[model samples]
Target: MAKYLIKSDATIKAAKPKPAPYRLFDGDGLYLLIRPDGKKWWRLDYTIAGKRKTISIGVYPSTGLSLARDKAKGARALVAANTDPSDARKAAKVKQAEANEAERRVAEGIPLENSFEAVARAWYAKKSSSWVPSHGDKIIRRLERDLFPWLGARPIGEIKPPEILAAVRRIEARGAIETAHRALTNCGQVFRFAVAEGHIESDPTRDLRGALEPVKGGHMAAITEPAKVAELLRAIDAYRGSLIVRCALQLAPLVFVRPGELRKAEWAHIDLDAKEWRFTVTKTDTGHIVPLAPRAVEILREVQALTGRGRYVFPSARTSERPMSDNAILAAMRRMGIAKEEMTGHGFRAMARTILDEVLHFDAHLIEHQLAHAVKDPNGRAYNRTAHLEQRHLMMRLWAGYLETIKAGANVVPLHGRAAA
Candidate 1:
């Protein structure tokens, strides 16, 4: 019997020096406990495993005798029904907390204010999970500077094709037709990423295929003429800037990779001792192998002595953590008096593409493999290139010899445009 309820006018009792368990009004089935030294607490009298169990509900007076009595009755019910009230209560609270958190996130997220720019960072973190590190910064930066400013905060679900089209119109308006197209692509990718992550219901940029204006210009010309190329190489050898400029000049002609690919070269990707460069991930956003040409090896070896300690091979001169400015090599060429008509940084790929096909007579697949084209294997699957090393090794040596001979101005002639011919 427990004296949980003290009837009016019941004689008030003083606790002895030693702690004793007391019951609320006789037979009330609730208990109050005082410790051996007057410390107090409430305990629910119960039974478990066929043995008596006393679960602490709370302290009396603080919890108050009435609350302790009610709590005791609840625990006693669990004992009678063969359940644990404490465990049940904890599980119930946990479930309620989870529900509350979900509700909070929903309450905070209005598809409008939680716009593309606002949530891009968290979205990028999710997107970058499977992406290679170098590509993460490139794609995100392009979006932040180009797309987010215009369309980021609009409720992604509410974003219409025309609304997206209008955003891209601003990019084209800035003389960035190619950039506008790329911005559209990026916009589509982000929305898709958002949709996949449950941030939005649909991608709005999908319908704007030809909505952005087309580029008016043609491809830049590559310089391969012995006299012109030699003049350019001669100028690069003397111009004063980062030693990386000289190294890039050598690697650019020898490897003939795109400017973007060359800039993101990471140490883990290149193995100079093995005379091979393995981009565990390639410029096409796929895995690629680069068989280091002798000149390519030599150039890397030199650049290594200067910047081996850094992450990017051609780290931006302005900032060690950044890649070399996309315009660094072209600017150097311009400084050496080479007009945009005479050559461009990207022109090196065209030069190699032409010479490797016409003069050297290399297989197109082998050439494309070296150039890191999005070449595919038999089932129309993305080709994982074992970069035609044996053939490339031979071709690269020959190409280096050919360039040297060109630099010496032997058997050299200026090129005429294909239409001119």
Candidate 2:
């Protein structure tokens, strides 16, 4: 409330350094406060919203008395003209803070030639929410274990095929040609994602055909023998690693959906009363309906006993809320003495295909539809639930019963049937 203009001697006497709140006038509404803690603070007192407001320009030693006076005079002029100095001060502070924030963000966005780890992290932050957690972890694990030491720090945009080939070739040197290919493919995807984000001009992984050795092709080993299929089922029933995966294993042959589709099942997708499991297959454009067999439904219900209230049906034992990784079934296969070349995650479909067509003679159209393959014919595209629906439901139940019979150590032939296996 004190007004301006105290002489130097009067100011010195006021600022004599004591533990008390006192003010010195500086030729306007501004004043310097000597806080009891021996700190100097400048205050310009005013009013707004029917309330007294004080704006602190700064501390005196840091924001000297002359400058404090100039700030007070400017604020006083605004007040006399019916402007609120407090709101103006707040607005200016906000502008300064916004400027600082913009500077920080711009600096953070400046792309550098980062290591594989850095780019992987940036890509992850941008894309992780869309991906399953296990998928995100696998991406980083592959980069760290396979590519980081060799090429992690190389700028992604500057990465050439030879550098990529060299990194992949390191894994190949350890005699894992498939792993070498997988590493290259994973890196290619990361590069593509980087390109989408304007981190690179083009993908360096586009034409690495000659760089990494091409895979030798023949025929994939499949469980073609009925006796062998029975043996495999028996082995699966006897698995000891995880009970949830065991249920998945038992359900695999019955439903015979893609291993990934089955493994990553969420709780909301099932309709037990309707005998359907609805899920989208991203590999194929259309949403798929898996007609659950009585056995498949039974397994799902049993799985739900432990996980129904949770987010994912086949939730990872490591964590709830997310489905088990796609590898969960394949790993169970390994424990059951099934070789990778003999069978794989997707090989469950192939396994069912061979048995259903060669052995049981179910219609090919039903099998294809059940596999969720794209049917290009416009009429086929507009398929009713009646067309492949009855056949698929029948095929699934028959397959389920056949598995149950084999699992029970009984010699069984798959039959189009009406009851639960």
Q: Residue by residue across 1-421, what tens digits does model 2's lDDT show?
A: 5554656534645566665677776644567777778887888777655777788878867776667777878888888788898878789889898667656645886323344556767777887776656667877788779997788756676778888888899998987787788888888778877778778778888888667766653124557677778788788768887778888887877777776678778878889999998888755445788888887888888878988898888889899966787678877787777888787766678888877776777766677778887544455455533456766787787788776776677776554533221
Best by TM-score: 1
lDDT of 1: 0.71
- For candidate 1, lDDT tens digit of each residue in 170-284? 8789887877887788778778887887878888776777776677544476686556777776777777877998788778888777787787788878988788777744334
Model 2's C-alpha root-mean-square deviation from the true structure amounts to 12.6
Q: Which residue pairs does candidate 2 place in steric collision?
A: 5-27, 115-152, 115-153, 116-152
Please give the distance, in angstroms, between residue 165's alpha carbon in candidate 1 and its true position after superposition: 0.8
TM of each candidate vs. truth? 0.60, 0.57
Error of 2 at 154 (Å): 3.9
Off by over 4 Å in 1: 1-122, 128-150, 194-202, 217-221, 224-227, 240-242, 260-274, 282-286, 300-327, 340-342, 412-421
| Residue 53 displacement in candidate 2 (angstroms) | 54
RMSD of 1: 10.3
Task: Kindly give the stretch of ten consecutive residues in candidate 2 with the minimal lDDT sum.
Answer: 412-421
